[model samples]
Target chain A: MSDELYFKPLTELAALLDTKKISSVELTRSVIARTKAVDARVRAFNSYDEADALAQADESDRRRAAGKARGPLDGIPVGFKDVIAVAGQPLTASSKMLANFVSPYDATVTQKLKHAGAVVWGRLNLDEFAMGSSTENSAFRATCNPWDLARVPGGSSGGSAASLAAGEAIATLGSDTGGSIRQPAALCGVVGLKPTYGLVSRYGLIAFASSLDQIGPFTRTVEDAAVMLGGIAGHDPLDSTSYETKIPDYRGELKKRKGPWRLGIPKEYFGEGLDPEVGAAVENAIAFYRERGCEIKEVSLPHTDYGVGVYYIIATAECSSNLARYDGIRYGHRSKEARDIIDLYFKSRAEGFGAEVKRRIILGTYVLSSGYYDAFYLRAQKVRTLIRQDFLNAYREVDAILTPTSPTPAFKQGEKSDPLAMYLCDVYTIGVNLAGLPGISVPCGFSSGGLPIGLQLIGQPFQEAELLAIAHAYEQGHDWGERHPKL
Target chain B: MSAPADLNIDHVANLARIALTPEEKAKFARQLGEVLHHIEQLRKVDVTGVEPTAHAFPVYNVWGEDVARPGLAVEAALQNAPAQRDNMIVVPKVVE
Candidate 1:
């Protein structure tokens, strides 16, 4: 095993493939072999088809050799979170409900990746139906943190982050509803971006909390994430929610931009529960930026304290509506002994969904149900507005806000068994999604436990380019990216 | 404030649809109470006259020209159904 290639950044991999120094087929073969080496212990993937991956890699090599290179990600291997569909591939979303479900067509994002000449390495694990903060709730299996096998890789994008951190793939795509993508990236010591809500098409992604979900990339560096956003961000006719907004050259912004950025720090974020080491890491990161001629100021997101309450209400409501299609009638799972059509609906749903998923669905159904709509769902929707306004007002005063990505660094696996305890892992992140803004989690420093800590940077809507540039500059300024967990 | 334990769990479970065993029902009631207590904190803030916002920004309402495009073929849509028999999706009969 070449240690040099194991955690190499995506750009380096692309260069190696382009110059004929290393062929895409060779890299694909190496990754498959690496996955085989670590899979039993890591449990990051639910499925992998080696022949198809190699075939795509061969296609990439042919295009590069002919000087008809597809795009920046021309020969890299990338994993798709199971919720996204790839034509002719099964997209189980790690649930029994969709266990045998094969997508008849490619998701708009999958089509874009293929057009850019990337190989679909495999489908990574996720929470059943993309619920839950820890992948422990996954019906398939929990994804272990690469840093310490006993600790969880934060989820619902847990497998996507673990794969990138463990060198199973160079980059992987993940969808964020609440903190799915960023939380896992923070826990895994990798970079992940959640593009502004409408920036990417959601045409074929298995629906979760629709209003909040956005697809983004988890990669080793800010620049690789930018390259991926370039490919996957675009409007699609099939998804009405996709933004008609222009796609900027996110990588180019890294060069053309300079910052004396006003960075906002919310006092609410540094409340009692934050770990001492995690607090120090964030302060040190802020100090580093201040030394680089940035302004650090205290800003109040007064509504910040209410983020979780509003998030659960809104997220669950959207999920309940989106999940209505899975009644055992149209697709996937069917109850073997249903006595009638209605019994089939009830039994299939009862048996198909896992505990956490059912909890959210029921909560969602309750809130949206006729009697409680005015008091619970309606009030949460109003609070959601106030939350968005708070960010909008804060952005007016600051170029971007800086905060600890998680309250504490990654915890021991199964440490947070109570579901509410698990949900708190997303407190710092969910507000950004609520605001429909772009946010990135970058490796900042290490906790006392020797696990990595991440600092989140959030910018105004459509400001991904500016946000990525600052993240890139910070990565260049620090030594955090050099440290990797020993596999 | 504690009511009959059975009543509280029954109300939530009947609404939620899990066939919780008696012990599981009791456990869930306790956990659910704790979670609801945390959420109850939001009620302390004054939100008078605040309009509820569903989307972050003001998006233009998109109404399309009234034109029909290709719809999915019936066979294509039903091809993945686990219990489809005939043109309709087949399932077990339900008793009223």
Candidate 2:
């Protein structure tokens, strides 16, 4: 019972816990044991404290016993991407800079999850400072795809998606800048959702790209994703960018908002680069929707070709500004060889950052510099407007847009050595982030090689409820998500 | 707009306050040059009257009421600092 308990979905575990069939401690221990057993091969965690997790689980069981159960999430163990702050826990961001730094306070999402009675589990690894498409950029170690250990787990949220797929965590939290959550989720065969920008607070998330970054969930099922979203989504004064709106019961809305809705297929997404198997899987998903009486239209988003180009400029510029805080003075890594204050800044950053990080910083700095600012940065922003306008214009005709979450299934580790080649991995998913709309990646099918493929649904800003329902309509009928990798 | 020549790595790295090795400098210049060349296509977009969007959803002048809130304890705040003395971060001397 304990052995198989690790792979059970959050909703199922919740019911068992409520019926007193299983205690939180028992479930947490099973997950811990599973993690300890499989983590050597998968390498999903940055750090986990078994005693701390069990203590939280014990407290949760005590609450439920005392007739004060918080909610469905109570006693559920959930892992967090290392970028999200967990008070007194190591917050490494998979970077050597913060390798020893501990978070001083809880991120808003962390506080909210704790309030929902979640047993915060462990710090999951990621690409260093959430910069790369593959977790190979991690200063610590690379996370392997559980399905095929030789393949890469699509990243910067590779650990979040891999752990959930490996059944080491029931549900996990991850941050998405450009397809980080969705791509990894697609590769790992799980449900990953990126809520509309500003819908979820970004208060304590280690900044990657301020305008593009969002915190979201990776769950085995759409229903679990909805539950996790409800626990973490809300406005907070702590994040001024956090939007204020009615927090609807997302799970309840799943049953209430049934849709035989109009879905658009952006032709640009299905073009040349998409793998044939992944493309066929998405086409079948569209056919499923059409057969169910939902209208499927081919909508053209003309500016789609420029998404990656525009994203690199805007995201890098924002990251450069946000990352300047790590100057080796107040906190984080400080170099011991510095002779002066200025030299300290230079030497520390040089020593602390990885190759990918330094390359981005230089690129970001060049784009934002005086002479090139208008030519590069400002022009990119203008093109960004056109890219966003393309999406808003498409929404005028359709309820949501459908596409493959990733172009191909998970590629082999270290397959994409060139920087430009790695950047192209996000072609299908970057547009959603550029437009700041809600998007979700649900398991559509598997590649012939037995690797998973994801179908992405893009919805209007603040329309995550409708988006989840659309994805759920197909997910409910399919058994693709039911299959697990043999570890 | 014409694409610029290879990036001046030393100048940009200095601006970013990072000291890169000679190998990194050469490699990054070539890589970033290709990326920049691709970005030059953005110049073709006609922006006659288009406004640049710094944020996807722009909010302006967010006002918060003057209220006292508990802050991180000094110990907690300084826990990760590399060097500290008497509740203050210790940095290299700016003055002789």
Candidate 3:
């Protein structure tokens, strides 16, 4: 019975809790026991507190019993990727640099989640500082894909994806810099939404590439993600980059969405490195949409090839400046054997950061350095403008853009030991980040060898409501979202 | 711009404030070169007269009401500091 409770979708679980069929405490305990049991192989969370989770669950139960429940998520268990700040909880970003550091206050997302009465769980592991495409860059441990324990769960939000798929949490939140959220969601066979950059506040999310970093959700279905996205997204005076826009009822929009949606499949996405099996699966999705009377148009996003190049330059340059804050002054680790200030700064950073982080910092520092800044950083940004224009131009012809979320399904743990090959893993999804638009990865089908593949649908900025509706329409047409990785 | 082969890992490491060993330096020089080569594809496109896009979403100067509010307490602020003395973070001395 406890094992059976692990895999129910959030909507079903909520209905059960709402009707008093099962108390929140009972559900929370089941999730906790399952997390402990499967965590030995999965390693999804870096740290979680059973006492705190159970206490919150009991409080939720008491509120429900008294007819004072706050909202749809009142008793729901939600996991957070480690980088998000939760006051008094550790905020490591899975890096040794902040291995012992605790946040002084809540990030905007955490505050919103708590406000919605979610039983906020614990720190899910991520790529150190949310840099890598795979969570192996985490200093602690890599989160294993639930579909196959030998493979990665995709990253930098690998743990978030794994936990939801493994039923450790009903839903989870993750930050996408490049394809961090969507790519992982695809590999883990779950729903992941990357909202438009400013639509969600970034006040408490640890900066990866400030310009590209946006926090989003990972869930079992499109509707839960829609519900949660509404919960967390809003205007905040704290995050300067956050958009000042009226929040939309995304779940409601999903309910009222009608027929005749337009979806464009970019020719550039289906070429070269794409695995044939993943291609065939997405083709089926296109046919399904066509059968539902939606127009399937072939569109051109001209600058798609240059997206990875432009993104690496811009993301790294911003991160170099953002990460310079952890220089052993106010908080975080300081070198033990420093002779003076110079030695302290150098040694502390050198000792603290992992190899991947240092590599990015070095690349970023070089690009932003005096002589080369215009040639590398400036050129990249100009190219970014072109990439954004490509999406903007394409949107003139289509309501949504559809493509494979990843070139292929999740590969074995160390298959991509070479960094360059791993970076290419995000080929199909990075352009959306450059344009700062909303995109989602919903489980469309699975690859041979039984790994899941994702279908990415991108929408105009601030049109997450419409985007979620499109995803929900396709999701309800098939049984893909209902399938879970058997642990 | 210089060729991708001349990315200069040591100089970059110095600028980044990290000290890389000879092995790491050699590995980065090779790896970063490959990444730079991948990025070099952008040179084919003409960005002449095009303004650089620093952010996907445009932002005007953001403002907040000029009112003071409660912030993180001194205790909480200093709680995560690796070395704190009397509510102040301690660092290596810079001035003589």
TM-score of 2: 0.98
On DockQ, who's better, 2 or 3?
2
Q: Indicate the residue-level lDDT of A441 in model 1.
A: 95
Off by over 4 Å in 3: A1-3, B1-5
When sorted by lDDT, best at the front, the candidate numbers are 2, 3, 1
Worst 10 residues of 1 chain A by lDDT: A1-10
Q: Positional deviation of B89 in candidate 1, in angstroms?
A: 2.7
Candidate 1: residue B42 lDDT (0-100): 68
Tell me the lDDT of model 2 at A99.
93
- DockQ per candidate: 0.47, 0.82, 0.82
Quality of model 2 by C-alpha lDDT: 0.93
Q: What local distance difference test score does each model get? A: 0.84, 0.93, 0.90
Q: How much is B38 displaced in model 1, in angstroms?
A: 1.5
* Residue A210 C-alpha lDDT in model 3: 91
Candidate 3 lDDT: 0.90
- Scanning candidate 3 chain A in windows of ten residues, the lowest lDDT window is A1-10
TM per candidate comes to 0.95, 0.98, 0.98
Per-chain TM-score (chain B), model 3: 0.88
lDDT of 2 by residue, A1-487 (tens): 1248888778889999999999999999999999999999999999999999999999999999999999999999999999999999999999999999999999999999999999999999999999988798999999999999999898999999999999899999999999999999999999999999999999999999999999999998898999999999998888888898888899999998788999999998988898999999999999999999999999999999899999999989988898899999988899999999999999999999999988888889899998988888898889889989999999999999999999999999989998888999999889889889999999999999999999999999998899989999999889888788899
